[model samples]
Target: MIVQTLPGRRAFIRENTRLQAPPHTPELSLHLADEVTPIWRLTEEALEEIGLPPPFWAFAWAGGQALARYVLDHPDIVAGRRVVDFATGSGIVAIAAMKAGARRVLATDIDVFCEAAVGLNAEANAVAVDFTDQNLLNAPPPQADVLLAGDICYERPMAEAVMAWLRRGREAGARVLIGDPGRTYFPKDGLEKLAEYQVPTTRELEDLAVKRTSVWTLP
Candidate 1:
């Protein structure tokens, strides 16, 4: 159960997830875990024993779904631009940006499993997305035309750090966007609302079957 190689991770993902479209972004497909998947039943302790982090990359969270939907619907935002999808779980937003005609996209996450997940999902959607395991927060602001983050404000320290980094990206002239479903730590000010959606999710993941999520950009 300990996945140490890319092939092992890919096999685990293939065995534990199904190729399905998120309810709010049906145009794209991803390898995702549902209630019926074995990964969904793993407890935190179980995951820790297996040397796996929480399988966040295996679920299309409501905020990510909303952001992906908005990107697909507003192609002009990323058309011909370079994009970086922060915390690119399942590579949903990155794929959406590529489908919307972005010249290139780099998907970054700290989880090692996410590299495989993003690769598989991008291949499924017939788009090529670059993946990185480096923690972008440790470096200078990303050099790209657009920066996208989704569902990242669950914890206060992490949310504050990420928001500060995103603000730096905005100051450096990159368009910064975020998608959140009313997370406790998400800042309530200084963002322009772009779109909102009632994204369908599982209770096991969100405690609610549908989440009212919104996409916002730094003004």
Candidate 2:
């Protein structure tokens, strides 16, 4: 069943799928559901409406949907855990973790703008999330119990670095979970698939080559 929205709820905003991206460029537009929304264009607008941020690098990739579906389907994974959304772009996974009952949620990103976005999105969802401008490339936070990442392994060097960090986190007994939508450099070994979901991508915002995506979980 589709998740139902609460009436006059200032908690979460839903993005309509029928909205079109702008012409002549790869930048897509979104509609915000909040009154003091921060989206500058249609792409940002849509994500603001959905309590998310416009795609940081590529709009319409829909990484948030993949993570959100996972949370809605399996709240048990995040229930009562201290979860960290590493490389949180628009705070999608972090928000989902909060919705799933994580004891505390921290959304970390290298991008400074993501901090503002996370704060705004968290306020929009009426959930508390610690948004920080820390980079996980050096190391995972020492206090993280569950490390969650989505759509982070697209580039080669970055993917390698992230995988190494994840391996270390796993060795340290932390439950490391990754939500990848078939990105180019996603690791293919030693990972048990937890779930999968079909997510939408936009040719107008990104390349037509990666129009649609499938979300996968690494155990």
Query: Among these predicted structures, which one has the highest TM-score?
Result: 1
Alpha-carbon error at 56 in model 1, in Å? Answer: 0.7
State which candidate has the highest lDDT: 1
* Model 2 regions lying over 4 Å from their true place: 1-60, 206-219
Model 2 scores a TM of 0.70
TM-score of each: 0.93, 0.70
lDDT of 2: 0.60
Deviating ranges (above 4 Å) for candidate 1:
40-53
Instruction: Report the C-alpha lDDT of model 1 over 1-219, residue by residue, as the tens digit.
Output: 556778878887888789998889999999988763467455333345554556789889988999999999999999999999999988999999999999999999987689999999999999999989999999877799999999999899999999999999999999998999999999969999998889999887887899999999999
Report, for every candidate in turn, its global Cα lDDT versus the true structure: 0.89, 0.60
